[model samples]
Target: MATESAAPSPFEDQVLAHLRNAEAAYHAEQRERARELDELEATRAALAESQTHARLLTAELDAQRWNAERERQRVECLKQAMREIHGALFHGDVYTLILRACLTISGATRGIYVTCTRPDGPLRVRAHIDIPAIQGAAPPPMVAQLCRDVLAKNDTIVCSEADTAARLSGDEPQGLRFRNCVAAPVVLLANLDGVVLAADKMDGEFDDRDIEALLSVGDQATVAVRNRHLERELQTAYVHTVTMLADAVEAKDPYTHGHCEMASRYARLVASRLGLSEHDQALVCYSALLHDVGKIGVSDGVLNKPGPLLPEEVELMRAHVRVGYDLLNHVPALRDVADVVLRHHEHYDGGGYPDGMRGEDIPMPARIVSVADAYCAMITRRSYKDAYPEAAARAELRRCAGTQFDPVVVDAFLAILDTPEALDGDSDDFAECGLLPGFEAMRAQASPV
Candidate 1:
């Protein structure tokens, strides 16, 4: 049935619109919340990643610092080792420093430095550390062979326990000595050959570090030894050159042909008897040899005068001391010896040529030369005076002791003269040194000048 048409109510329409708006606002709020949540998650992940990278960077920095410290320590250790090796003065000192440094660096339980002057000779152990004492003991068979091998190849070797065992024969016992070793050759000179070996590390097997250490030590030792060898050669050459110059001075006069040699021997013996050190004895001996060197500057007329010298002539003869001192002082190496040379003619009681330094003022070496020089003069024959008998010479020494020479030195020389074959042995020594052709006849002559 159709009824009259009904119009829509305003309240219903307004309510429906409000509900639609509310639903739309709820959906928009949900979408905005989701976007905020997504942004939060991304920020958290970025924070986590940054923190992880920071941790890794921190670790790397720590590693770098640790490595730097280790390298610094290594360099410092090497410097100290160089000091020890280079400071050494003699061959034995160098050998000891090398072995000790090796043992310390490698932490070896046993170590040895073996060398030989001749290629074919057996290895001689120059230095060792932590070795059980065995009388007349030689190196173990394997070690000897290893040293020879190292010497031949000039190689640096790092051997493990297995390698050590393999080097031995199959029949040999297991777990033998020298289970691990670091060995290197010390090769520098043609005449010298050596091997430095460190064995049985306390903590671990031999490694590259140990081999490097051994090689470094061997290199240091080689350099030090080479320096000492060169120094010795230079010193020998200098001695020969000076001795020849002194010899030239003597060659000018036949009467004084061997005067310097005789004086040198006497001075050495007297210096030793006086308890002087070997170094001091050498200085005195050399000074005595060159005491008359300046006599070459004197004219032949005055030098070979058959009678006593006039006042002026005596002054000229005495000037030889100053001339010798000046000649020696010009050489830098002889400056110290020149000091002694200048004072050799000084008398104990102050009556002498040159500066006339008296008593204890004279250098001990020069004082020693004085006694030796006077003694030689008393026993030697000259154109002006005959050689005094030994008894007369001794008496003259005693009479002139306090006045012209140091009494203590004179007493020491007198004691040496009292040895059983002392005076008799002089003849053989004189002949050996190419002294005047007839020393026996010279000793048989009359009074001293």
Candidate 2:
């Protein structure tokens, strides 16, 4: 029984060994598959991290690009404003340009330029732009007060919706419904010339960026204002110099004591009555004043001769027109009127001296000055003649209309003389028709008197 049992167990033992080996091989395959899966997962995780980092870098780069673009736009806008401001300065339109530049730079729907005529005077609108709904409306009291504050502090005021509400919510009257407002002073040499205001931003509430842009525009406006101020000063100086020269000429002859002034006033009146352009009016006025300036080249004997002039003295007197033309033609500012001055004594019939330009061939300004000179001379006593009565002067002007004067100018002047305004002694001061368009107030402000 023992020998048979031992012989039969060999097959069973071999089968058991095979089964154990198969189980070990299956475990080894499972371990290899698990390790491969872990390695694949680690690669996937690393790829995901790289993608996230790339996305973050892209977002940062986009943000930087946006910031750079915004800065570029800001700089471009400021540069454009500066260019416009300089153009305005060169052209003498600072008030209008300030409002336009502020509206452009700040993206405002409404803008106002206010200036105080005097240091203590109330603010007056120099220029303004508004939406249709608020057209022709006066500036809100609060807004005006804000402008005053800018003048007072010599600083800028920026008001958001909340800030505007807080400021206007109190006892102050509020007619404005704007969501934003910006105001800056037009300063020059530490003196406040005026305040520039912008309101109702078209895009959004005004922020520090808008404020800073407005400040740059204000700085440009300051330069323009200073330039305008300098130009005004220079113009005043030129006017004074010309007036003194005229005065000196008149002083040399007692008979001509107010002749230049009378001629200028008459010329201005004639120009207005003729509906001449302001530039032409100015030309006529200045030409009449300086018509006799060439007399400075004449000898005292020739200029002050109480009796009729001999042919030689008359030739010398006639030389004054050419002399004045030569003298003023070289001056840049007076060049435009030099021809007018030279031809002021010319006759309408081509019988006059110098160029003998006739009718329309004569410059309109010169013709106007000619009429004025004749009128002034007829009414005022000269070295060779006594003053004529108004009626006699009018008759003389009418008699010489087609010969020594332009008939149209004579008629216009005669009509002006008939007006009640011409009878008023102070009418010259009230007559602003000779002022350039939109420059009457500016000229008045610059008047030294």
Candidate 3:
């Protein structure tokens, strides 16, 4: 066997070695290619994961931005509502201001405000805003009831199509229909003052955000209403004080017992007949009541004397107008009426003392007070002169219309007395006041041809 194993070919052995080396190199190349492919796959997978993460972050960022925008808008609406409420408080038109502010904040088409003096009292409609048509129409029963529920609960109610049918199943509005609504209670502590309602959203359906906004407005409205009540109380106290002062002045003279009251009544009537505004009418009445307030500064000797005043006494009596001006001008609240008091004696024909303002130069309130004072004085039984008869007083007023009184004011005063029932009750008092029957005929007789 050793002999037979003779000499294997060296070439064959080398070829075999070469073949083995080539096979090994091919396997190594295949392994390298597989590794490269595996690396490429891993890189692609990592890149895909990064892209997905970036997309997720972008979506989250957009959501955050949207939320921030909504929050900003909500804050802006609240700020605007606060500003409007402050303006309303200052202007003393709380109902209108609150309703308008609520409408702006909620973007509602219509709004209604209601209040009650007592908890069990009937509701009073304070203000309303309806588009296009309808002025101050009463709220629907359902809406009113919903407002009541809000008050009872001391919270806000939001009604959409989802709940409106269930909440107001059997009720319907009279003129308009609503698809969405919101109501809030205006409360201070445990006391429910009123309710505020908003309906028919302009943008979309009302939601919880709207409720929150309205509740905020409701709180401000409650504050405004409270302030209004306080202001009214203060005004009443001030008026009472002023009236007492006027009474004291009138008490100094026995003949002028009812002079201030009569003059104020007559001035108010004339102002109403002249179609003056409510504020102006009040001004005229108050000024007439206080027109003789300066008499306090005059000497009692001249004021209470039963005889005609001497020239010097008359001069002293005339000085009262200036004194009253000085006294009232110091009070900020009464300063506006002070000018009217000072000019009340000024004649339309430029013959009166103090200013001699002629015709329209006189303030309308002063002119009105002057006419009322003159008529009251003429009809009053004074220490120096008997009271003029009704007819005689009317004739005298007509005779001196342009000379001592404003003709326009005279006409208006006469017209006020011309009503059928103007002198209906208490013939004695009417006669004493010189408000005679047949005033229309008297005015006709006094009219220039």
Q: Number of the top candidate by lDDT?
A: 2
What are the runs in model 3 whose C-alpha is more than 4 Å off?
1-84, 89-92, 116-124, 130-144, 160-177, 187-192, 219-226, 269-279, 298-301, 355-361, 419-449
Taking all chains together, each candidate's TM-score versus the true structure is: 0.64, 0.69, 0.67
Best by TM-score: 2
The CA lDDT at 218 in model 3 is 59
Error of 3 at 213 (Å): 1.2
- What's the C-alpha lDDT at position 118 in model 1? 50
Residues 1-449, model 1: lDDT tens digits: 88987776898899999999999999999999999999999999999999999999999999899657745665576668767676553323667677777777777877888876554567777677764323234555666778777766767777888888877766443434566888877655444467778888888676676677666665556667776576457555656656776877877766787777777777777888888865576677677777887787888888889999999999999988878888877755455567777888899999976986799988898988898888878889987889989789989989999999999989988787766534443533322222111212222332134
Q: Per-residue lDDT for 1-449 in model 2, tens only?
A: 45554464888889999999999999999999999999999989999999999999999999899768766876786677666666554344667777777777677888788776444557777787762223233455666677777877877888878877866646543436568888877655566667778888887677777677776765666766777777667566656656676777887777777777766777777888878877777777777777888888888888889899999999999998998888777665666667888888789999998877788988888888888778778888877889999899999999998988888988988888867656545524213323222233344444456
In candidate 2, how many Å is residue 308 off? 1.8
List clash counts for every candidate, in order: 0, 0, 0
lDDT of 3 by residue, 265-303 (tens): 777778887888666777777777788888889877888
Which stretches in model 2 have alpha-carbon errors above 4 Å?
1-83, 114-145, 148-155, 160-179, 185-194, 221-223, 273-275, 420-449
Q: State how far residue 130 of model 2 sits from its true place (Å).
A: 5.1
Native-to-model Cα distance after best TM-score fit, residue 274 in candidate 1, in Å? 3.6
Give the winner by lDDT: 1 or 2. Answer: 2
